[model samples]
Target: MKRPKPTRRKRQNLCADKGYDYPDVRQLLRDWGYTAHIKSRGEEQSERKQIPGYRARRWVVERTHSWLNRFRRLLIRWEKKVEN
Candidate 1:
């Protein structure tokens, strides 16, 4: 099936978590002009101790996730469709 096109332009400077740390992911992000802010999961905690900005940014992302979860439909997975 054909995927829907994005409403916005292609992205740059993607701030993904460690889950997107693989070479393929990083390469793709780079190809799109995105400075992948993804660190290896094993290095994440250690890196935070060295870089205050990483800690701050990570927390903001986490807080945003928590906020998104506050929506009842998102938290409960109310939709029967896979998109939900």
Candidate 2:
């Protein structure tokens, strides 16, 4: 699959969990013109205690996966034919 090209008009942002909190990943994101919003391990927990109504970036992605999992067909590969 082809990757989408970054637009110069507006800046792009990449939200990821602590697992991707590496120097290489940060450099790659910078090269790709994305504003990385990756937090270090335990950073989110500390912020959550101090800030009210603070939400982690990964929460949205996890919620989306939870919603998608409700659909049995999508959770499992039931279609053998690509046209289906």
Candidate 3:
């Protein structure tokens, strides 16, 4: 299935974790005009480390994902209706 179109304002930034560092995901974010702040696995190394202002927000996203995973229906896409 194709992704839904975003109707929000422009220049919005998306903060995600290292798991989302794939090329296809980055390309899709670019196609939607979103500035991706996803951390790369390699960046965890001492030589590549750099402090980012949005680094504090990464934990929040990770926590939300973990919480969502607690529900079997949502985690496995068992729910069909959006309002369900």
Candidate 4:
């Protein structure tokens, strides 16, 4: 099967952690037309202190995972039937 073409946007953002904060990774992301939002190591804490209401992109995914974890059935996939 042929690969589907990705939809292009005027400003596409890529949220990543400090591990991806490298010149090569940044350049690759730029080449692929993504605006990288990867924070450098130890940079987040300082920014949090300076900015009153700053929140990183990854936190949203973490928060959602935390919320889902509260539901044992959903997290563990207790239901075998798809209809359930």
To one decimal, what is the Cα RMSD in angstroms of model 3 from the true structure? 12.6
- True-vs-predicted CA distance for residue 67, candidate 2, Å: 18
Model 1 deviation from the true structure expressed as Cα RMSD, one decimal place: 11.9
Candidate 2 overall lDDT versus native: 0.83
| Residue lDDT tens for model 1, 1-84 | 984433236544567877777999888767755667876777866866887665355788888888877885665766766776
Error of 1 at 49 (Å): 5.4
Best-to-worst ranking by lDDT:
2, 4, 3, 1
lDDT of each: 0.70, 0.83, 0.75, 0.80
Provide the lowest-lDDT 10-residue window in model 3.
46-55
- Please give, for residues 28-61, the per-residue lDDT of candidate 4 as tens digits: 8887877899988888798799997777789889
Pick the winner on lDDT between candidates 1 and 2. 2
Error of 2 at 5 (Å): 2.7
Show pairs that collide, candidate 1. Answer: 13-34
- RMSD in order of candidates: 11.9, 9.2, 12.6, 8.7
Candidate 3 residues 2-56, lDDT tens each? 8545544656678999889999999999888788998777666543345444344
Q: Which stretches of candidate 3 lie over 4 Å from their true place?
A: 1-9, 47-84
Off by over 4 Å in 4: 1-9, 51-84
